[model samples]
Target: MESWGNSTTVTEFVLLGLSRNPQVRAGLFVIFLVMYLIAVAGNSLIVVLIVVDSHLHTPMYFFLSNLSFIDVCYVTTSVPQMLVHSFTERPTISYGRCFGQMSIAVCLAETEFLLLAVMAYDRLVAICNPLRYSLIMNGKVCIILALGLWTFPVLLTLVTFLTLQVNMCGHNVVNHFKCEVQAVLKLACSSTRINGIIMVLASSFTLLFPFIFILVTYGRIGFAVLRIRSAQGRGKALSTCGSHLAVVGIFYGTALAMYLRPQAKRFTNREKVMAIFYGVITPMLNPMIYSMRNREVKGALWRVIGRKVGK
Candidate 1:
């Protein structure tokens, strides 16, 4: 009887997606559908172009291809579920699947954190020590970095695991588009101190640490460029850093506001909006950011198109 009682409680959760209004929901469905399609296609194209174009197969493109692939997975992990809930009147998800989404999201977010850091280090080596760049970020080193990106995130899985311990008491409604961490934790009747602490600690490691590393790398790159005598060389170096800084600003700004600022104890409508900004908008724009900022990417894209047209 005790086991059954515990099991039956909160069998599933209802996600009160973006809106209840028919017009708003219809509009949102189309919007997210378009965003998803573009994000996948754009990122996949980046990956494929890098692989096929021998000139593009450097450490930077390797990391970029990995980033593109992760963007596909990260967006897929959340957007499809949101799309499903948009049209359905109920917008419900089972308990297992809800937590499952949380776990996957954590994994992807952590992986991106480390991958971005490795990319920063790659840039640091490239700009600050151009002659030794190949020796430092060789194929073997890059592979190890990629492997660690995927493997070292088990520490974050504990957040969702701890979430399972919270007692939902059979009431099944989550007031957001997806199974966001803080939102789901709100449903629990028991103490959530551990979960909250885990969130903060995890956020600090994944967000703060990588951010600090990137800043230090840029600092080094700045000093290195100042030593260059040619004006054109300095401009080229600054431009590369500018593109990466833009991505970092968008990603960290929204993500920190959404997760870290939730210290107020509840996930609010504002946080949902912030989530949409980082979760959907940022990923969609990443490819454009890279391609538009870097001339090489644009040239490679045209070459690929030209090859296809020639055939």
Candidate 2:
């Protein structure tokens, strides 16, 4: 079936992007480019510090390194193209590339959600079962978890492709800057009920379930903190969990808002803006939050810097 308003099978799509005005586009280009650069550098530094510092060889840092890596990959998949499109006239993307972006971006994002849940569990074990933490989160298990985090996204890509049928009508103008899944799907001439259903299920599994897990895990952690007799001990315990909680709050808040919204009709421009904020803004902010709130990470970073100076 051909698209209702369009006649040709869409081979490529023209992204209308955020602005049509040259001045505004140029300003946005500069802003997003700077944000992308900061995000890459910040997350890259976190991964490096985690890998190089022996003191950070614990499970928490290991998971954090993976999270940083995913953040870098996630920002790269989406932001660079947006920057390019901001400058170019009538920015367009091929059908294949659009899905390619969607695959990589979604995979990275969902994997982060899973990773965060695992991190929450790690925190739980560290706090609640401090004596048995080592035995419980052993080297072998960490390796398996890392491998699973890396591998599941690939499987998700395949499942997403096979299950969803999207036949785009001739309407090839994508509303957002990049080839977002929702926006691209809107071009489809055929019914998207099945796609919506699958996305809802996938969203529940990837986003909702993990979110609930984090809440419950943290709730227990909060109670565990309160049980400590000394105020200093309680403070230390809460501080340990603070940075992760902050990061989770920002990442999940924007993401849940973006993905969980109804897709029955075309999304508003405000929704598009929210997508850009989370896709670009969150990555840049995560490193800052960790550095400011996490003392150990700061120490590792300073030690790394000192080593460079000494050498």
Model 1 superposed RMSD (Cα): 2.5
lDDT tens readout by residue for model 1, 85-192: 787988888878887788888788778878888888888898888999999999999999998887877655664465445667766778789888788878777777
Q: Tell me the lDDT of model 2 at 236.
A: 77
Residue 221 CA error for candidate 1 (Å)?
1.8
Cα lDDT, all candidates: 0.81, 0.84
User: In model 2, what lDDT does residue 293 have?
Assistant: 63
Which candidate tops lDDT?
2
Q: How does candidate 1 fare on TM-score?
A: 0.93
Model 1: how far residue 308 lies from native, Å: 1.9
Top candidate when judged by TM-score against the true structure: 2
Worst 10 residues of 1 by lDDT: 1-10
Give the per-residue lDDT digits (tens) of candidate 2, residues 1-311: 44322334777889989889999999988998899999999999999988899988999889988988888998899788888888788898887788778888888888999998999999999989989999999999999998997788678766876678666657888888888878878877788888888887787878899999999999999999888898987887787788788888888888888778777578568878878766888888878876546779889889989999999
TM-score of each: 0.93, 0.94
